[model samples]
Target: MRRVSIFVLCTAFLALTLSTGCGGGGEEGPPDSGTPYVPPVPDAGPPDAGPKPDAGPLDLAPPVVLSHSPEANATGVPPESFIEVNFSEAMQTSRGTLQIIPGDGLPNNGLLVARPEYWDVTRRTVRFSFPLGLPLRAFLTVNLANFADVAGNVTQGFRTFAFTVSDGVAPSVSSTSPSEGASSVPLSTSEIVINFNQPMDTSVGTLVPGGGLSLGTPSWTGNQALRAPITSTLVNNGLYSVRLENFRNINVKAMDGAPYLGDGKLDFGTGPDTIAPTVREASPVEGATNQQYESTRFVVFTFSEPMDTNLGMAELVDGSTRTPLATSFSGDGFTVTCDAQFKLRPGATLRVELTGFKDRAGNALVTTPFLGSNGALDFTMAPDTVKPYVTQTNVPEGATDVYPVEVFSSAGNPGYRKVFTFRFSEPMDPSVTLVTLHDAQLPSSFRNLAGVWSPDRLTMTLTISPPSSGLPPIEADKLQYLELNRLKDATGNLLDTTIPPLGDGRLNFRTLLNQRELNHACEHAETQGPLLVTATSSVTAGTPRSDVLHGLYELTLPGSGNTFSGYTRAQLITNQTQPIFMNGAPELTVTDPASPQTGIGVTLLPVPPACPSITHEARFGTVASPLNLRFSHGQQRLRIVLEDTY
Candidate 1:
């Protein structure tokens, strides 16, 4: 058998070798003798193709903004400059929202209606154009959102920026002294003054003189005014002309870097000033009564012609004592104002005397004493004893149940009229009468109070407004007070607080309580009980029931009951077992079912009482007993007894 197998294997090996070596198509192969045979490995689908031909890296990052025109917070940008934005990558043009919002001062103060003009060839930049151009000197904001790349990645980074447009109005001259075609201008005028409509760049511009006129070095006072002094004496009855060349404002420039427009030539005729300056008007006219006596008081003298301010001397005289005044001249040299070095005595006749004064042409005054006959600039100072005081008020002292209709109300309400009117004994100085309104209950509570003086300056109408943030309002059910500090009259006399009624310059009044405020007070009286309740009777027929009920009573108002039930603390001492029911209206009423006499009938005068006198009545058998009720501390302490009729 072995021999036979060996022969068969030899024959198969030979056949496989011939077929595999000679390229014959045959599959005769076997392992040696007893070895195991294995099948050929399956194909791995074309050898993996070398990592699938490399598709490149993933695009997971967001797109970025590369740059923008009219850079962030850039000022003085041309109004017509196109706005452009460049992105780091090509972006989708139709996928974003662009808005241009004006910060201020434009017909369209809100969002500007504009659209992108076009995207560049690379699709990375976009430009926007406004047909009418942006408003001059306006602040604007450019906002962008949802700008995505072609790869579906939204843009990341700053999406909004602000810029300011340039001022476009050219500089021009508003006015000039010795105006165009002016005649009889003073030959002694020291300078040619030019006033610009706006501030100018003083570094540039020249004042060219003509008509035999020569100008000295020019000087500027606050860039808005230019002064060119005359170096040579001007000729009398001569014509003059001056041209302002290359003058421009600090912001005047065109987009092409061109200079802005400026004022043209100014021409005038000069005439000799032969007339002497004389006092034409005086602040305190001769024989004037009741002038201010304070040191800050000014005695002014207006001259008929411009004067040489440097050559002037004046004095204020009271009797034989004379004092020099600190004097200053008006800009045009047409008025001389004198300030007193010391406070003038009250109730004195004062006179202002000008000894030596000259006009611009060195002409002396015709008369030495310039104002009145013998220069009697005489005026009487107000007497210090004649002080201002509150004569009357629209709201009376200790007034109760007063409505704050005019004092405090919502806007547009007819009740929004003056709340208080204070009539003074004399005309008071409105500037120094610092009258303020405050809350009596809240010591630190002050209102936004304003006052309007009558035409005569004797009466003031007060209006109260809401206080600043975090402060309470002057609402209903409040005790308001008025305070006058540093209130003075025109003569600098202080307010007299020793007057009747408002003795301390203060007036207290109570506002009427609304339904909500009354309910709140009732709730507080209920929860925080033991309010003092004192009572007495006026019936003299039998045993006079004086102090009928005087004790701390626990109050209870159950479930919207406008009536209060009082439980006395000392029930045995009072010998009162039945509960006393008290009505909680403006006219309160008290009753007890167990009592034979009609229980105390309390009538609150003026509703919400502010130290108000109340009327009370009690009945026993056929006699009617009159009583008086008083509320001391709001509704905390109450008394019902016989005192005044009302």
Candidate 2:
């Protein structure tokens, strides 16, 4: 093979346990002092022995130690010492037959569980270690029955005799009952357990209570586990411990299923694991009204795990000015309520800690002396709170237009309606738009229509799906109104009430809620004309010619000023395109300027009221778009709605 070059990569962190493939030789034990090798006189022996008897090759295989060491039946060895084995020959390194086993209650002794670094064949030696818990001269027997020599030969000898270690003192224990910092000890507590560095006596039948601690019962969780039933009672949540100095431990056994040496008490802890509390977002909201918080309310907290109820309370602070605050807590966790008066100085925050706390087991916060640095929540408050208002709508007072169709009802009744547009001078949050219909007998709903925005998130273009049906005619007749409130501008200022439904970020106009438009332009239709206005005593009354006829200038919303009274009068005419029904006696409607019937706001003229003493109303009309011969209809006005500004 060509010379090899190895590229270096980062070294691996895990350890190696098993090894593969080994080379070695098989051999017998050292020669006995009396046996000597003798050389044969080849030719002479063959001639003297006559036919040679077809002899096979002489066996020169190395010797392997089948049995030896500790001389079996020996005594007085350290109880802590572990058993070992040796072979006369260097063996193949592996988990193969060369590996050793212990003869005891539990077998497969190389190790109950193999560790990654345990199976290496380094220098033909393998070792394992563990501590013992029993007290007595324990006898241990190791077997060579499963291993083989390097030549793959199964040695016929399987060493089985055993040896004993001297009984030794077990572990020692300091204290047993009353765990550190225990508050109160309970009499209901049962089973007083103690611990020691060494194993102790545990034959229940012996009746010798070691260390004055009672062992009233002898029951193990199983054949290999241990437990003690003491005479004292352990109240719930009481502290206690087991120690050899004042108490006794249940006798522990060895791997060989026998007690070796026993003495001291051992340690065992109990209880459940606990979780830390969590804190979530606080309220009164970042920039909203910051008035009196005396009724401020409780703070809510979320936790990642079940909190240790024993960990105690959390203190609240108006961190802004470092002012101390009184706080209340909910039964669950994390959620706390602070006195509303605890104002967060202008722009400030707070923090919560979960350290210096302990669970029932005295398990401190995972963080040593946990000063609760791992968690916290923050908030900011604002002053200066104001209200909102509406500006003017882009519709004219007493506006009138004509159309070319009898598309509206013509039973000598007045029916009219239209849309009004408004423009704002500044940017606004569409969510603040408050729209409502004023008249009765109408089903109303405000849907946030889809809109386009101007460059920044500032200006919003919103639409309203006007009412189509489910309303009485009265609301549509007299007049429809528009009201608005809570309109907010970009800089977070309220819209000026003096302004129209539209507004600019800075200020608004305080315009009164009074305005009206005349809708009397209802009559016949002519392919080409301004409009027709035949005046009867009223738009709803079937009046005779005797009703003084007049032009479409008399419009008023009762309490609103009679704005059209100063306008010039008009003749009767009509635009056949826009028409309406004679419902609500006489109702009036406005029109969208961008529509085909833009100037057709005046289409039909209504008959005057036969009884002038009665109120006059007007319904609405529909506009149509026409092609060379075919015509497309514009918006249909079936009902009218109105509202006031706040």
Candidate 3:
């Protein structure tokens, strides 16, 4: 047919050029149809295989955080701490994650997850378990987020860290109040305390006032005690010392906060009273004469033992010029005064003298040529025509509650403010009675101030500030008549707006919330009998009414770290709000008992309004039972049925 189809296409193209071998020189291509053609090699299939292209997507890399363990800020650490971390590869233990964060004294807020107690088999370390042990002085932190890595790559961590724990136990001074070589210790021995051996850190522990001794405000009674007090200048029997100074800022740390490593000092003495404060009673009684010009004068001295209110004074001569006196002292430092600017000439004669005194043991009064005969006086005057009048007052005119205890026992409890005097019968004219003695209800720019007058000007006092810590059932409403009405009288007249108290002078009174809690339990009674205690519960029946609800009885003696000297019913009710009824033997005096009959009593009852009820009571006495009973915040639960002492 076309030559038999070209001989079957030339025998299938010569069987595809004899299985695809195109020769060059010995060419058989196309049957040499062209003599130089060589083309048949197409069977290279099976050797080319088929599966190999993904080495491209399996390599990741992000998992770091290869080490950890209480190593960050470290520090003592022993309340039972445990933290470990380590992870650079393994990890993916279900995605991992952890968090801790607490800073001071810790309470809760810590999270964790990595299961299997998070062991270390390529699960990449972990291990955190504080259960209930990490809190004494805490700091913590430790984060470690997300975590991954089984090629899921994550965790590239540093995570976060910090650590503290502390049990290295350091804070010392287990006891001391006047002990170490203690002698008579009384310049009125205010306080000393100290205790410690643990539980401190309310600010590091500081007492200071060293060698010559001074200290005044240093507080803290429970977490191991502290107290302080002293300062009214102390001295008296002299030879003091007092230190402590540890501070990381309050430093005295212990409960694990550590600190209080050095300075504790101590040493005491004072109780010889060497007798040197004369003037044991003065006030125009040393020479006596006519007296009475415009009255309102004052001189008072009475000091047989404690004085040195920075060396007192009081002058009014007529032949040596000297006038600088503004005194005030009587919280039992033994009276002093001077008052009444001294302006009386009438028949003329005057003398009065007295000078720079001293006592608290340093002794020294006869200053220059004055105090020689126990101090001078002389007097004479007597002309004044009579116009003043308001007689005595500190809170009387119809008294009701009353007990501002002279503004918190002379500078304590809200302390300082609460003045309120008013004597006047004459001596008027402190520029017109400090601008017309006021408090009419207050604000005429609020006047009413004219203290220090009685050396025979006939009296004229009038003060009036009050209110920082006294009126809560504590009293002071009726000042009823401390009035003055533009005052006058040094010889100018005026004052007597028709009497009834210079014209209305109202001073209504009303505070005695239990008479300053019975004068703070009769000034802290202590019939003597071993003493050392501790009690706490500031307000926990419902929580909230704190005019100082009494939570710490703390007297220190029942064993651990003793020492806790006088004054503490919260330093005698600070910023008080009444409600007191204390008792513990002569004001808690243990002197150094520590055992025997160890008793400490306290009672605060008067928080009745609606919030948390409140009515406290506490008694401690037990060297094997002198009668130990304890109760708190009223609900009425006194059983009483003992009988097991055989």
TM-score of 1: 0.26
If scored against the real structure, what TM-score would every candidate get? 0.26, 0.25, 0.27
Q: Candidate 1, 322: how far from true, in Å?
A: 42
lDDT winner: 1
Candidate ranking under lDDT, highest first, comes to 1, 3, 2
lDDT of 1 by residue, 45-161 (tens): 444322232345546567777789889998877676778888887777677656677534433543433234468888888877656777788888888777777656776643898
| Residue 497 accuracy (lDDT) in model 3 | 56
lDDT of each structure? 0.60, 0.35, 0.51
Off by over 4 Å in 1: 1-98, 102-131, 135-139, 144-158, 162-169, 178-180, 201-203, 217-219, 253-263, 272-646
Backbone clashes under 3 angstroms, per model: 1, 109, 68
Question: Higher-TM-score candidate among 2 and 3?
Answer: 3
lDDT of 3 by residue, 211-272 (tens): 57777788887666778677656654567766565532123233322233233467777767
Residue 570 local lDDT, model 2:
19
The residue-by-residue lDDT of candidate 2 on 1-646, one tens digit each, is: 1111111111111112113213555555675698674433333332333223344443335436544444587664455454445556544444323222343333354323323233335323333334652124666654545444444544466556566655654323333443322345444335543322433434421223432334566453432234467675332333344432322233332222112212322322332333322333344432234323223444444332334454444444564334334554456533445443323333344443333434334444342122234443344444323333333343433222211111233364543322234454444565554544333223253223244345533444433332453222213233333444455655466656554333322211212221122222232220112222223322232221211222222222221132211111211222323222232333332333235244333333443321222223332232332210111112121111111111
